[model samples]
Target chain A: MPAQTIVPVEANLINALEDRGLRKTSARSAVTTRIETASGAFTAEQLCRDLPEVGRATVYRTIRHLVDAGALCKLPMLDGAPKYSVARNEHHHHTICSRCGAVEEFRHSTVERVMRSLEKEIDGDIVGHRMEIFITCSNCLAESNRGGSSGR
Target chain B: MPAQTIVPVEANLINALEDRGLRKTSARSAVTTRIETASGAFTAEQLCRDLPEVGRATVYRTIRHLVDAGALCKLPMLDGAPKYSVARNEHHHHTICSRCGAVEEFRHSTVERVMRSLEKEIDGDIVGHRMEIFITCSNCLAESNRGGSSGR
Candidate 1:
C-alpha cells in the first residue's frame, strides 16, 4: 500500500507567514494545526464546522493565506464547493467516490506520458492539469448489490 | 486537423425533454438552440448576459432541465464558474489556455486504458472522469516570447 503521509503544515505555515512579513496570530496557528492534522481534502466550511472555536472569517482568511503562500492547493469538487489539500512535492491526481465522498490519491507514469504527448500534439505550453475519476467504492457497490439504498 | 463537430442540439434537446415529460417551452427551445449553436462551453451567467431577452430564472431552469436530461454536460472551470457544453455521444476531454481562454478538445485510447487499469488497482467501479489541461496557447506563448504582457 502506498504510504499516506501528513504534510508538515505547522512549520511550513509559520515559515511562510514570517517570510511574508505576516504576524503569527493564534487563529492562524489554530487553523494551520487543524489543516496539518487533517487526513484528506476539505472545504473552508467544513473547517469552520469542525473547529467551532475558530471564527468563520478567520478560517476563510487563513485558507486564502495558506493557498497564496503555496501551503495548500485548491481542488474543484463536482456538484459542491471546491476543496483544499496540502501542497505536496509530487504531482498526483485524485479518484473520488461519488457515493461515499472518499478521495484516493494516485500517480501513474502513463498519465505523465500522455500529458507530454498532448502538449506536443496541441502545440501549447502546458502549465497544469486536473484529472478526477468519479467512482463507486467497493463497499458502496457491495451494499447496493445487496439491495441497500445508495446515497450520494 | 481534427474535426470540430457541433452536436445537433435541437433534436437531442427536444427528444430529451419529451422523454423526461418536461414541457417544451420557448425559453427552453431558445436556450437549447443557443447552446447548440455555441462554438464552446459557456456559463449560465454568460447566457443570461448574451440573451438579455431570456429571463435569468428561465435560463437557469432550462440549464438545469437540460443537464438532468443528459442533453448538456457541466464542466468545471478553474478560477471561474462552471461551464456547460452540449453532450455528445463520444467521450472527449479539453485543454484550456489559462492566458487566452482558448479551449481545445482531444481524445485518446490511452486515457481509457489507464482509467480501466486504475479501476482494478483502486478496487472501485469507475463511473466517470474529468480531465482538463491548463496551457498557454501558441498565440499566448508567441506573445510572451516577444516580451508582450499577457493577460488572464
Candidate 2:
C-alpha cells in the first residue's frame, strides 16, 4: 500500500461533515476514525465501548450521520442488529462466522459472474444485490465444539 | 408455483417445527406461509398486521425459527430492521427505493468481476462488498411529479 494514498479518509471526512453543519467533535471523530480504520462489520454499541468517552446518544447520531453521508454501509445481520462498516467504492461480499460474528472479505470473479447470470435469468433487467456469505469462523467452530451456550 | 408443491411443504413445515418442538399456532402457519410465498424481503411487522390473532412475540419467534432452519434469508434495511425473504441456494442483491422502501431483486455479474480485478490491481484484496441500486419505481416516479411524498 502506498504510504500517503488513502491515508485514511478521516480528515477529509471530518471537513465534509462540518460543511454539512454536523460538528466535528471528538465523539464524532472517534466514531469516524474507528469506522475508517475498521476491518469488518460493527455496531454502534461496539463503537461506544471502544471509545468510552463518546456518549451513547452521540454514538447513535454519529453512526446515523456516517450512513447518511455514504461514509459507512449498514448490513442486516441474522441476529437482527444493524451492523455498519466503512464504505469502499470497490465491491465485495462477506463470509461471516455465525457463532462469533467474525467476518472475512472475499472476492471471486467466477462467483460474481455466476450470480449475475442467475439474476438475468430470474429478472429481465438487473438492478442491484447484497451478497453476504456466512461461515463458521475457526474460533467459533472451536467454541461450538466446547458446547458454549451464548449465541450472544 | 405449483399448488401441490406448496401444499406439501406447508404440511411438512408445520410438522417439522413441531418435531423441533415449537408451538403450532395459526400465527406460526401464517408466518411460514408468508415467507414461503414472499417474492421479496419483508419484516415481521408486515406479517403482524396480516395475522391479527398472532401475538407479536410469536411472530418474532417464528421468523427466528425460519432463519435458524434456513427457511428464509435475512436482508438488512438501511433503517435497521431485519427483512427476510424466501431462502435460496443461490446469491443475488437488491435494488431499493429510498423513499417508499420498495425493493426489487437483481444481479450484476460484471460488477463482481470488476471489483475483483480492481481489488487485485489496487492490491486491496477485496474482502466483501454490498451494492444497492436506488431509483424511483414507475409508480413512485409518476406520483412524484404530482408532488406527493412519492416515497417518504
Candidate 3:
C-alpha cells in the first residue's frame, strides 16, 4: 500500500494569488468558485451557504482581499448587508426590487452616455460617478399579487 | 388672565410635504434638514447622532418614505450601514476612504466618455450607469499616521 502526500491544486490561479500574498487554502478556492459561479451580486451569508466549511471571518477576509485586488466589487444595500460581484471589464449595474427585496441584472448604457455628456457640460473637473437603477422585478410582482408586499 | 391655545406651527416645507400625504411634524422637518445638509452619504444612525430627539424608527420611516417618493437615493457602501443621499437631476459617483470611511466625490468625464464609447463598441443598448471611485480621504490618512481609528 502507498501513502499519498498532499498534491497542490489550482496551480496557475494559486500562483497568481501567491504573488499578491493570498493564501491558497481550500476555503479561498471554495469562496472564489462560489463567487465566480454566482448569477449576480451576493451577500456574505449567501456565499457562506455554498462554502459550508468557510468561517464568516474568512468570508469577510476573502471579500476584502478580492475587492482590494480588483477581483470583485462591493454593492451596498439599503438594508445594511453589502453584496459582492465579480469585477469585469464590462460596465454594468443592478435593478433591485424595492417591495420584496429582489436583485437582478439589467444591461443598458444610456447611463454611461449621459454621464459623459454631463462631464463635458460642467467645468467641474470631471472625475468618476455611480449609477443604480431600481425596478420591481417579475418575481416581486408575483409576490405582490399574493399579498406578500404592500406599496407595490 | 387669558391664555391662548398654541397655534400649530405649519411651516411651508410642511405644507409642501402635506401634498405627499405626510404629516407636518417637527421630527419630519428635522429629518429632512439633516438629509438636505448631509455632504455625502449618511446612515440613519449617523443622522440620529446629530439630532438626538429623532428616534431611530422615525429616521428609518422618513428615509424609506423619501426614497419611495424618488426624492432620495441610496448609495451602496463596502461595509457598515447603507448610506443615503438626496436624488438629483444629473448622475454622479462617489469615492470612499478605506481607513476612516470618509467619502469624496469624483467627476472625470473621460471615464464616463470611455464607458459610453465602450458600450457602443459592444453594440449594447445604453440605459444608465453608476460610477464609484474609491480613494482614501486626507483625514483618515492623517489619523492613520498617528495611530488608527479608535473604531469605525
Better of 1 and 3 by lDDT: 1
List, in order, the clash count of every candidate structure: 0, 9, 21
lDDT of 1 by residue, A1-152 (tens): 54566445447766676677889888888888788787777988999998898899989988888878877777777578888887764588887788877777788878888887776677688899889888888878887888756543
lDDT digits (tens) for residues A1-152 of candidate 2: 87777645346556557768886687677877777676778987888888888888988887777777866667666455767776555566565666567665555666567655555444233345566655556666566568677535
- Report, for every candidate in turn, its global Cα lDDT versus the true structure: 0.79, 0.65, 0.63
Candidate 1 docking class: medium
DockQ per model, Cα: 0.65, 0.19, 0.21
Best candidate, TM-score: 1
Top candidate, metric lDDT = 1
TM-score list, all predictions: 0.83, 0.63, 0.59
The 10-residue segment with the lowest total lDDT in model 1 chain A = A1-10
Ranking by DockQ: 1, 3, 2
lDDT of 3 by residue, A1-152 (tens): 44465445433333445669866889887777777665767888888777778998998887777777766666776566777766554456665555545555444556566665654444333344445545555665565678765644
Worst 10 residues of 2 chain A by lDDT: A120-129
The Cα error of candidate 3 at residue A131, in Å, is 3.8
